[model samples]
Target: MEITSVPFLNPEEYSLFCSFFQDFDNDGETSVNKSRKIDEKNKSLSEILEVIDETEIPTSKFEIPSSEFENRASEMGDWEQGRVRKGRNQSPATFHDGETAEDGGGQRRRLWVKERSKGWWKYLDSDECSDGEFRKAFRMSKGTFNMICDELESVVMKKNTMLRMAIPVRQRVAVCIYRLATGDPLRTVSSLFGLGISTCHKLVLEVCAAIRSVLMPKYLKWPDQERLQEIKTTFGSISGIPNVNGSIYTTHISIIAPKTNQEAYYNRKHTERNQKPSYSTTVQGLVDPRGVFTDVCIGYPGSMSDEQILEKSALSQRSKLGMLENTWVVGNSGYYLKDWVLVPYTHQNLSWSQHAFNQRLDELQMIAKDAFMRLKGRWGCLQKRTEVKLQELPMVLGACCVLHNICEMHNEEMDVELRFNLYDDEMELDSSRGISVNALQARDGIAHSLMHCK
Candidate 1:
């Protein structure tokens, strides 16, 4: 038989393959060796046929998978004679940076492993990224965002490891802010940032810690004596009440049930309002005249009343030390009346003095209330059921408060669409009269002055 061509094997490779067979001789071989050589040659031939058969079989993945390809190759008449020629060139699958490709399923091909595509964060960081878009995503203006990055750069900046370069400080801050701003899960953040889920989670906690450590002292703290004088004067001018130190209020931050103490986090007020089981942690804040937080007490159980959190706060300790002597931070009925703390008369009375006092104090309390509203509205993570562990809530929430102060300081107005209505249930105290005789007398004096003097 004469061999002119064989299907599949390319022409250039066939000459060398044929020479190997041409050089072999069977004359000196034993019977067992002869048997082995015949079997090996037959096996090789069968394997070649198997491969050709696979290519010829129809598959939905390819347009021409059947005899069309085989017909293009030579007939069996040429292949049986031992001639082999090169197969047609196939379009190779696309590759990226040495990574695999998303090939249409081919039998011999390995499916590509894809890296997560980063979409949102890139758009946010680009030059075309509008300040409005940036603010919408992060709930703060670009200047405010840059300021935060600059403040936290020293603490939050990362070092590159041998495996991969570290995420930039800005990105770390963005991850934390995005998670807080959108209240999205870490997996959602991971997809947006093209980061691993665990990496996103770690970044959030680390950046929040950095914010608490570095920015909190500067932006969110007890106002100094000079600062207090300004706050009191401004607050007095607005509310018609003298020596108004700060406006105090408390709000609940919804959260998932903690692993160990689930019942403690259960929020009865919110659960009742929503007509379903709900859990939360409390955030008590005291804001000055400008709706910037002067002090914040965070991460107490939702079950704890406003007064309970207040008792545990540094503001309470400051009062005891007489640092807040002769001045009052006004609260709602949720808190007891005290020398440093003032509550409006809870009793029903026709007296003009009591009515005027409650009205003025309630007006003053709105400063803290509005501050909490913006805090939750801006950092949406505080408004939603956060996925972070219970122990981590304090730092995360504390960071949110600090950021809130910074935005307020920068006069960053929240987008109108992002405005959140706050509804904090205030439980009326059992007794309106507090233990402090001085506080009771002082309340009377203020109430009389408001009605009679003003």
Candidate 2:
């Protein structure tokens, strides 16, 4: 038998034919010829078809059970490929009984057991989940968390109430307060804790108020008799010199205007202009030699001098508090209430032959000044910022004194030796100077009496 062959068209001829026949509706084998022409217009399609001609497709409708097909595909490492390419119209040769296509992807579903050994479990154990996850897990909003914390705090204050609120509230509040006390910037703290900046600021203020209300009265107070004795005992233990002279050390009240542009400019020209300035309120405090504070008063205008403030101070009403009349106050020249004030120990009382004695007295004053400097360095200078109000002043000063006492008690090895040597030198100088030993003794006796009475 003789086979007829069709002539193959050149590329240009095929292109022209496809362009013409793309819109053609010719029927029968002529249409198939036109389709062939369109396909041949692209050389890439021709090359692809050449490769496809070399491959084979299965002719029979063969049935391998789904399980068996999956096992075979797994062995061949084509299970994922098969699933990805498989069509919905064509029944798949393999099936996973409980598995579904996870979001129409190549990924296969398996039994998810929430394995505690891997993945999220590590983060969960470390409490290191992201904020979103934490919020979801705790079933809380940020506002809800704050409200819960407030509720817990209220319960803690009530004392007699049952713990109806959750414990997480207390834990969260403590964490918030700790961050605030560390002086972390509100914005940074808020971002870290997933809180608003305003919320963080409010939380800090409220927590500070809570601490002041709850802890101040119980832990901080004026130096009563018991506290004075404690202070005296502490001084004696470290200094080896008992506090026999318990003079009242009164601090001057000076309240300048708060730092501002106007104040700064006014201060610069005050002397030149001979300007009288407006002042804030005063802060008055009475301290002992051991730095134990008592009998604090405030609220006078700052324009008043130290003498005026002291005269009006509640310290003058010693008799009302059962305090003695003979208590001498060691103060600066501003407090020269001749009968009541003891100025810095004077050297004028020494005789001409007691030259070395005056020098020795000067040395003792220098040592005391150095000790005061050290104490000032530790406790810091008293400024308007440290003074709160009249009633609150005692507690503030008492807290500072307690801290000073702690340092004196625990870290006084060097200070004690220095003070002892200075005291001995001064005592020798006092004898040589023909200083009124009887009067000095009497003053000391009065101080000692006051210390004992307190």
**Each model's TM-score?**
0.75, 0.35
Per-candidate local distance difference test: 0.80, 0.41
Provide the clash count, candidate 1.
7
Worst 10 residues of 2 by lDDT: 420-429
- Best candidate per lDDT, number? 1
RMSD of each: 11.3, 19.4
Which residue segments of model 2 deviate by more than 4 Å?
1-212, 224-283, 288-292, 298-301, 319-321, 326-329, 338-341, 345-454
Q: Candidate 2 overall Cα lDDT vs. reference?
A: 0.41
What stretches of model 1 exceed 4 Å from their correct place? 1-114, 432-434
TM-score of 1: 0.75
Worst 10 residues of 1 by lDDT: 84-93
Across residues 168-204, which tens digit of lDDT does each residue of candidate 1 receive? 8888999999998999887788999988898889999
Clashing pairs in 1: 5-83, 6-83, 6-84, 9-85, 10-85, 10-86, 11-86
